[model samples]
Target: MTSIQVADQTFVAAAPELAADVVGDRASWRRWWPDLRLEVVEDRGAQGVRWKVSGPLTGTMEIWCEAVLDGFVLHYFLHAEPVAAPPAEPRELTRVLADSNKALRVAGKVMSFEVKDRLERGRAVGAPATARSGTA
Candidate 1:
């Protein structure tokens, strides 16, 4: 019964804990999802957070930070349905769903890229990378 679902992963050249800090910012949440209200369902610290979304949509959203080569992969997931009644006609429903899907998709990408741009300022593109975990 989900009308819109966005699953995105963006790699950032920064520590997981650092990325978590950026993702956990309350002000940024309001800025990124002004139309939606999010209440924390779970706080995973350096990993990320799960939120119960309301307002424009009703469902669950999460950002999972997975440690990767020299950085972390920020996974954004938004599973929601339109708050208003969906179109009755098939064609209208398709159009509405597509538009909503695209909008949410773009929003997720923009948010992740902003984080990447902010934290990976000087990282060289195409550089060979390896995950930094445990002790050497």
Candidate 2:
């Protein structure tokens, strides 16, 4: 099984509510990635939780997540067989994967910083900060 592992540290503005929301519905992940479906395969309170995701990717991913009242961290392992051979050259595949990883890392950092900033603003103003920060 070809494997891709990704780790993301996310900060939620409403940590408590967000944690509850995430832990509440693993299936709801479909709403985020329309091409993917996630099902909770295991739930271990405090220690961690794991889920299986399959769809267009045609793979089983085990997402081990650790939750805290403020935010949660996720380690995802994607084990999938390519649906089709790359339309591009093999060298291109490496480049594509590198680009994808870079993009995801950038996105994760932006998202985490945004959420943290929003939480800070919310605390300062006593209201939720849902406004775009222009930076992102």
Candidate 3:
């Protein structure tokens, strides 16, 4: 089996709890990494999560969050092999790598921008904000 590996890192400008809510929440996870069909194999609260990836590439992926001085650092790791036969040409390999890299970048953007916005705005991503105690 041909081996494949990918690593990406991004920082979310929010607390660990907020970052986790955006990244770890199943709904957001699906929205962020729509290309990947992943199931949680391990859930490490305050640390991150591990998932079994399916689809074109079959492998294991993990996303972990670490508290940093400014915010939270997101670490993404993927190690897997193609589900089908290996790419026949150098071009094919390049194409596969490009696609995967694009996906990673998109994920990073979603986490850093979309997720951060939702969490920092005082509401969970996709969850409605609750009424203030006294405000109408």
Candidate 4:
């Protein structure tokens, strides 16, 4: 079986709970594999989530999403054999790996941004409004 591994880390300027929600939900997870159908296999709080994805490429991808008190990290491992023999050229393999890494990085950034926005909105709503000087 062929294997691929990729990892990315992001610092969320938000609380751990907010960051965890973005990384743990099904809707958010689907964004990573827009072309594939991903079903949640397991979701344990503060630990990880596993997903079974099937499409033109069929396999299970387990994403161990952990949230430290400071930030969040995602580690992914993909295992599958090509439907047909892969091109023998080394460049072909390299290209495939690079593309996969790029996709993961993009996904991580989106998740982090969403969490930060959510936290900022929550904070704004909770804070008291300040009166303008001499305007009232």
Top lDDT model: 1
Candidate 2: which pairs clash? Answer: none
* C-alpha positional error of residue 42 in candidate 3 after TM-score superposition, expressed in Å: 1.5
Off by over 4 Å in 3: 1-4, 122-136
Clashes within 3 Å, all models in order: 1, 0, 0, 0
Give a tens-digit lDDT track for model 2, residues 15-99.
3323333433445444434566656677654334465666554556443445444444544455554454554788888776666
> In candidate 1, what residue range of length 10 has the lowest lDDT sum?
127-136
Ranking by lDDT: 1, 3, 4, 2
TM-score result, candidate 4: 0.58
Q: What does each candidate score in C-alpha RMSD?
A: 3.2, 7.7, 6.1, 7.8
Q: Of 1 and 2, which scores higher on TM-score?
A: 1
Candidate 2 segments exceeding 4 Å error:
1-3, 12-18, 26-28, 44-49, 60-81, 99-122, 125-136
Error of 2 at 124 (Å): 3.2
TM-score-based ranking, best first? 1, 3, 4, 2
Q: For each candidate, what is the lDDT?
A: 0.84, 0.48, 0.69, 0.54
Candidate 1, residues 1-136, lDDT tens digits: the string is: 6889899998887767677667888899887888999999998987999999999799999999998867789999999988998889999999999998898888889889988887666656875342234422
Q: Give the TM-score of candidate 1.
A: 0.88
